[model samples]
Target: MAITREEVLHVARLARLSMSPAEADKMREQLDNILAYIRQLDRLDTADVVPTSHAVEMGTPFRDDSVHPFEEKEEILKNAPDREGDFFRVPRIIED
Candidate 1:
């Protein structure tokens, strides 16, 4: 499919972009090339092909959740500039 210069200008206006005549011409060419590539891809035979979210096979990247209790409570709390018992004290932001 060939992209028109007017269509490119219309898209630019919709996107709130200020395009010069030269820039619009360039954009029109690039969009035309992309559409041509898509048209080329449409000629492929994919009757036996499976639709997938990714191009390659993917496995779950996440590990099984395992709870591990933290041991150094006092040692960690020692770094706090201000603490109220086991919690860090911060200035009250909301008046309730």
Candidate 2:
């Protein structure tokens, strides 16, 4: 399947691109080569081949999730500029 210069220009227009004649020519050649390669791949025999989601198989690398209670609440609260009892205090942001 050969790509035409007009097709390349149309795609460029759809993408909101302003291409010079030289750039359009280059893009058309590149698209033509890509389509030619796809045509070649279409001729390959895949009757016995099994389809796969990825080229390589992989295992999940994530660790099991667990929760633990924090032990240093008073130590962390020492860095707060303003505190109200057990929580950090900030200027009121909501209006009634």
TM-score of each: 0.45, 0.45
lDDT of 2 by residue, 1-96 (tens): 498999999999999999999999999999999899888867889888888788888996786688787999999898999999999998889887
Candidate 1 lDDT tens digits, 3-95: 899999998999999989999999999999999988886788988888878877878799679988899999989998999999998888997
- In candidate 1, residue 14 scores what lDDT? 97
- Backbone N/Cα/C clashes per model: 0, 0
76: Cα error in model 1, Å: 31
**Candidate models: Cα lDDT each:** 0.89, 0.90
Clashing pairs in 2: none
* Error at 40, model 1, angstroms: 1.4
lDDT for 59 in candidate 1 is: 84
